[model samples]
Target: MIEKDIDVLVGERLAYLRNKKGYTMRKVAEALSIDPSYISRIEKGHIPSIKILQSFAELYEVKLSDLLESGDGVSSIKIEVEYEWFEFVETMK
Candidate 1:
């Protein structure tokens, strides 16, 4: 898939999951310590860092691969996907 395709797919999945979980964009942004506008941008097909995606997946109790992979379409190309949880949290030094 092209970069644009991936962006749109991820964004669609994010929006669906957020709405399914009954979370407002503001609530998610507040949990991530980011501006709500950033979340809006993300939902509108802005590709963010892996860490940010991971954070969202962890927050919503979703597999990061689920967030990264297309849910409705099958790609003939074999793409190996991997993800790790990097939940947004602060730790004392």
Candidate 2:
């Protein structure tokens, strides 16, 4: 899938998870020590840094992979491939 498509999917998933956990963007931003605008940007398809994504996963008590997965029939294999790519990029950093 295209990178932008992945970004949107991740953003949607993030929003869903945040809502499910009863967190406002401000609350998530405060807990993650980031700007609330950043959370809005993420929800609007701005890809966050790996560190930020990891922080979100921890705060939400979810696996990092869960954050990357989309609810809309995206295959697990595809998600896994993307996740491995993310892990590789993180390791390189």
Candidate 3:
């Protein structure tokens, strides 16, 4: 179903944002005052309610649109890998 795909995409975005911010699931859970397992479930493609999604957007400091988008107009792994490598290089300095 379309809704299921959207959930998976949103979940992927959630996981990506959490990782990009260097936050553990426990940290996010604590910030949201939610069980860590719930965060894990959301990251595993479970469709959370709109309220929960709004909370995640706030916690991650991102627009809800960003969480729902297909990734900045690009979906290529090559681009993502190169970008991540560049980010890693920056952290090394």
Candidate achieving the largest lDDT = 2
What lDDT does model 3 reach? 0.72
Off by over 4 Å in 2: 1-4, 70-93
- The 0-to-1 C-alpha lDDT of every candidate, in the order given, reads 0.72, 0.77, 0.72
> What would the C-alpha RMSD of candidate 3 be, to one decimal place?
11.3
Model 2: per-residue Cα lDDT over 1-93, one tens digit each:
454467777787788889889999999999999999999999888988888988888898877777665444432324435567867655744
Task: Please report the TM-score between candidate 2 and the true structure.
Answer: 0.75
lDDT of 1 by residue, 2-37 (tens): 445667667777888888889999999999999999
State the lDDT of candidate 3 residue by residue for 1-93, as single tens digits.
Answer: 124465667787888889888999999999989999999999998978666887888988876656655566322221122465345434533
Runs with alpha carbons beyond 4 Å of true place in candidate 1 = 1-4, 72-93
TM-score of each model, paired residue for residue: 0.71, 0.75, 0.71
Clashing pairs in 1: none
Residue 14 local lDDT, model 2: 84
lDDT, residue 45, model 2: 86
